[model samples]
Target: MALMITDECINCDVCEPECPNHAISMGEEYYQIEPSKCTECVGHFDEPQCAMLCPVACIPVNPAHVETRETLMQKYVRLTQTAA
Candidate 1:
């Protein structure tokens, strides 16, 4: 599953750089996670980076966008792929 930022987020900008997929972004008052780009750290780390770095632990699994490991890995590859 992808990850999401909760209303508890402080928009400290600490989690942004920790994400390898660049999925974290600032919102009007809190940080947000792009579900399309969130891989749950499948390709780049042993665990979810945003959740790891979140001071308030606002990062949570996106129940609305459930995805299997295979799907997440495929998306990771697609996201990192570059033009030839």
Candidate 2:
């Protein structure tokens, strides 16, 4: 599942840079994670960078965009391939 930034986010600006997939961005009121680009760090790290780095623990799995580990890996591969 893609991780989501909740309203509890302090806008500390740390999570955005930590996201390996460039999925996190500054939204109108806080940080937002793009579901399409979020891979839960399956291809780049052992865990989600943004969630691990978020000081307030505002990042959580987006239940609305639920996906399996294999699916996330597939998305990561597609993203990397497109970037290459």
Candidate 3:
């Protein structure tokens, strides 16, 4: 599943850069993870970068957009599908 930012977020700007997929962005008053872009680090890292660097620990799994490894992989494939 993708990650999400809750209202508990302090808007500390700690999670933005940690996202390898560039899925996290500064929302109106919190950080938001784009479901279409997030893979929970499936194709990038062993763990979710936002959670690792988040100071407030406001980032959590996006249950509304739950997806399996194969689905996440497919998302990753489309995200970086451009020819080299």
Candidate 2 is scored at a TM of 0.97
Top candidate (lDDT): 2
lDDT tens digits, residues 1-84, model 3? 988999999888878887878898888887789998998998898889888888878788888999999999998888888522
Of the two candidates 1 and 2, the one with more favorable lDDT, higher being better, is 2
Error at 79, model 3, angstroms: 0.3
Residue 76: error of model 2 in Å?
0.4
- Candidate 1 lDDT, tens digit per residue, 1-84? 999999988888889989888888887888888999999999899899778878889888999999999999999899989412
Q: Which stretches of candidate 1 lie over 4 Å from their true place?
A: none
* Candidate 2 weakest ten by summed lDDT: 15-24
- The lDDT for every candidate, in the order shown, is 0.88, 0.93, 0.86
lDDT, residue 72, model 1: 98
Identify the runs in model 2 with alpha carbons over 4 angstroms from their true place.
none
State the displacement of the C-alpha of residue 61, model 3, in Å, after optimal TM-score superposition: 0.8
Off by over 4 Å in 3: 82-84
lDDT of 2 by residue, 1-84 (tens): 998999999999998887889998899999999999999999899989888888899999999999999999999999999999
